[model samples]
Target: MAELVLDPESHFPEELGIYFWLYPYWDQVSVRGCGYMVRWGTPPLVISILKFTPLAFMVTWNAHPGFTIPHTNLCDFIVGNGAAPVDLPLGFSNIPPQRYPEAPGDEGIVLHTPLAYIAERSK
Candidate 1:
């Protein structure tokens, strides 16, 4: 299981739309056990993964209508206080930066993680 920890430095000053696209090699995968911890106030995070294929999906987040608090101060509530653990299938390898065929000009950041969660399995 791979859990996403929203680091304090990665927190956004305001509500920003974030997204992630995943394409695995497994026949099927499941994501469960999502929760949050309350600090000074509720963190803005409500993630939902829409699985389009057996090994492909898109990650999305929707802030709670009531948790509309601006992140003006660093001492205030943290961003992404609540993140879920993603259950990855077996035999997953590395995640190399391949040019997205659809968007060859697009580029993304490389995140350093202990576990190989967001990796592509060689067919």
Candidate 2:
């Protein structure tokens, strides 16, 4: 029998990862035949049965021909290894970077540079 190898480009995941902002709206996550925009938030997890997944979805959806994240796109995929769970502190959406310490109760700090942005940038 001939062996078949699935390259990264052709691999399709059984489930998809979800962004944290969509956590509350997990019910809204669906597999549309078209495609979906995915951006990393915290870590990979399965919320209920949603898979709360991220990487898999991106690869699968993007595998389709002519897939693209537009120049005018409002979002970009925040990539992560999805290796483990993320434990964010209260009101802190992302893990604080070494250069920038967590500023609790400091709205000004976030106004210009949000922790989420910092985390995304760190990635």
Highest TM-score against the true fold, candidate: 1
What candidate 2 gets wrong by more than 4 Å, as runs, is: 1-18, 22-29, 35-81, 88-123
lDDT of candidate model 2 versus the reference: 0.24
For each candidate, the alpha-carbon lDDT, in order, equals 0.32, 0.24
* True lDDT of residue 59, candidate 2: 20
Model 2, 60-92: lDDT tens digits are 222323333211211133223323355432222
- What candidate 1 gets wrong by more than 4 Å, as runs, is 1-22, 36-44, 51-55, 63-123
Q: After superposition, how far is residue 39 of candidate 2 from its true place, in Å?
A: 19
Q: What is candidate 1's lDDT per residue for 43-68, written digit by digit as tens?
A: 52433222323233323245565543
**How much lDDT does candidate 1 score?**
0.32
